[model samples]
Target: MKLRSYLYIAFTGTLIATTFSCTKLNEEFRGELEEADAGNIDPAALLINAYSSLNTPYQQEQRWVLQEISTDAAMAPTRGGDWDDNGMHRAIHLHTWNADNGYMNNTFVSLGTAIYNATNVLRFNPSNQQIAEARFIRALTMFDMLDLYGVVPIREGESLEDFRIAPEVLQPEAAIDYIVKELNEIITDLPNNGPTAAYVANKNAARTLLMKVYLNKGTFINRQSPTFAAEDMNQVITLANEITNSAKYTLSVAGKYFDNFAPDNDTKSTENIFTLFNKNGERGGNVDRTWNTVAHYNMRPGGWNGWCTLSDYYDKFAEGDERRGIYYDYAADTTSNRSKNFKRQNVGFFAGQQYNWTTNQPLMARNPSTAPLVFTREVTIRTSGATLETAGIRPVKYAFDYAVTGQRNNDWVVFRYADVLLMQAEAMLRGGTGTAAEALDLVNDIRVNRGVTLFTALTLDNLLDERARELYWEGWRRQDLIRFGKFLEAWQEKAADPDPKTLVYPIPSQQIAVNPNLVQNSGY
Candidate 1:
């Protein structure tokens, strides 16, 4: 797609101005950062900007909204007027979205902007490590674009003067190849997994991403009836094995499962392979939105009372699964200014009466005076009943940061070791590269850790259900559902969409309007 000249100039000016801490600039040079002076620019600053660009798309609103709300795992129902957003949430959950959808348009733009910012780093005098990091970021954004839109616009080394020229669009197959090639080439220069490297582009992270690409490449190529080629599945197994051999990661056990998403997860989580770092009152994605988005207003550390999982998805979790819900203690710190007087009531699914942790009193629903705030399992698209204010099963994936008052310290998890294990098991199951016993063993290991019973046997259906139970609301539901050939099936509030074209989202109409090379997906 063509990058508009004004937008390019504005982006460059903003990045340059922010990176250099320049408070003033002449009107004539306002949006022009001269290419001739590129030698003097700090490559590190540009790289930092590339990393920072990922915050919005991966966080609560843009990409997460598209990935989660459109699947059976989660939905943001319109509570009376709140979260209506002109039926955007309803359209996504119901699979009625068109090219004009605001969420789709914004997500497309955000991913595109992130790609541009990362690509901009390559044009500067960056070191080998910096170049690798930039390419990884660019590849990631491209992968997301490919996954969500079934196509990707690639602008290679384009200058501001060439902004009018539309970039070549890579179809699903070509996009997969391009991303695979980029990740493979950059693996050596990427950092090795470590405490400080979780937020950076690392070797294990690349391996994990490669596994995802290979595992889902079939679905990307043919979402309607995905056929996992033996070769691709083998590649997934191989890459997953590489990450396993790193000896740098392990699953967080029962009781500690929530630690992977805790405020201090950078140091506490053994499962996180790649994450976005957030520091209290500093810089990072709004990780606190993990709780605020689904929590009730009367609950301690009041939330917006939006977004929740369907009853069908919630039913997948068996009893005593630590991932379902568990009480987590965040004892108040008297000495730290960041710590609050209140604590979190629980850290997983909130299905019944909510409470104020500080007072041990049931939280009362704001809309219905004197009624307990009981989050219900039965929620409709347009809720209007006794449970209007607390409909659906609320998920608190990330533990509340009682310590941090504003921005949280929770590092948003992108890749985890548990996921790596699951992918490996799935690849083995699909490709027959390893015995069924081996695959069953791998899956049961995770189940055991999560406080669930070991399975006597394994199947694609059970594996898909296991993924849902283990990774709900972490933003892989839609992709997983599509890969399993069940995305179009009906569940909870959403109806079955027989049209295969619904598998891929429409290219934003505005994008197609600007760039003739862009075409809308089939069913839009």
Candidate 2:
């Protein structure tokens, strides 16, 4: 992802030059940030660098790291998935969903680092246009941390280390207010047409984030009244409508719905709002795994793990629904059996150096025992743990081939326009002024346009299922379930927790060790 390499390309000059800025601040606490390198790099560019930090592979919208505990999603390969076990990630995320620890803390701490960088640069000049953009980026990352783990410490000042050491002091509601209040500035200041409209922060990106912040203002924090405020809905709907009405971007052209998500093709697609930007040759993060995690066999040998999508969920689609095909992949074996592909893949050799998850052992079945193997070439697999049976399913939708790069495929689809439409519909439905009919029609448009044989009247359940079909693995399931009021309950019943103390994850221990003032979320 863009954020990983940011420490390298994004801030090398600024970080070095930042030493010179040191003289700009007073000798007191702000002194650390004031130090400067002789490079004289623009502080605004530093803030832009900070915004780019959020596009990390671990923390991107597909949530390669966070989806394991979701109700409809899970970490594939069981023991193979790190943080999926009791060591740290699993204990904090899987064992308990509500508390803050491990995965939650890592996400918090990473975002905190970005915030600290942004704030440090902003401190030099808060009124600068770049400062506003930096603040917007910080706000976006903070939303992920705050909503996932409530009442986090919100100290803002200089340097990554300075803000980090300050304290984990709990924030008042004003802290949340500060984020929302700051967006007005960002929205006004960001360009009507910014750098690479698909990836950079723009007016609409600011608005979309504003909608999210307001929608969860009450529930995420212990505010008051309904968690989703009526006023918040109005703002959200207005923003969604603005994006919808804009001729700048629209839904995927007719039947090429997947075009919105087809990775290599979206170098300049209209649907993208903000995604982890990856130039084919510049990739430093392994982002294509989201597709690899649920891809079909043609993309990789021995097929993918076929983990998330299942027949139960797949059965909801009416015959010939194009949306349904998007979720599942079917391949014919040499013998002509229809292979149900649920998981998708990114190509690579054993222990795929680029997008392949593991390549230590060649999938034995796909290759001769005496065959000499080459890197990036996928060998066949002997059906066993993780490998699917002939009649079983393989991941399909998210799969892609990256022959050029070993592990860095510029093919991961993060944000899409279809999702924008659904968000608009959900905001309308939850806002209480909209009817299910409109939502139904929105879904049917995609289905019918895609050549659905039979269209049934849509209901709330149908809409939710449609979302699962349309947005699977794009990383909205957990939030969708929470909004649906089904996360705590379904996961609780599934895990059989006598008292399900999971609504959020626990703070990471590494962070707690560093910041004592920070308190872990309840029931950790």
Best by TM-score: 1
- Clashes within 3 Å, all models in order: 1, 57
Which digits, one per residue and each the tens of the lDDT, describe model 1 over residues 1-524? 00100111224543332111113342224335553477876777777777777888787778988888999888899988799989988999999999999988888877887787787788778889889989998888888999999999866644222554566789999999999999999999998865445888789888888889999998898887788889998998888888888888887877889888877788788888888767764467778788788888876678898899888888898888889987665432222222443444377888888766656567789867688888888999998767679789998888777765887877888888888888889999897499999999999999999998999999999999999988888888889989988889998888899788889999988778766778878878
Candidate 2 lDDT tens digits, 205-286 = 7777877676666656642223666777777677777776665665555445554444443443456666555555653345
CA RMSD of all predictions: 5.7, 8.0
Q: Give the TM-score of candidate 1.
A: 0.92
Q: Pick the candidate with the highest lDDT.
A: 1
Model 2 worst lDDT window (10 residues): 329-338
- How far residue 215's Cα lies from its native spot in candidate 2, in Å, is 2.7
lDDT of 2 at 270: 54
Full-model lDDT for every candidate: 0.80, 0.50
Off by over 4 Å in 1: 1-31, 159-161, 330-345
TM-score of each: 0.92, 0.73
lDDT of 1: 0.80
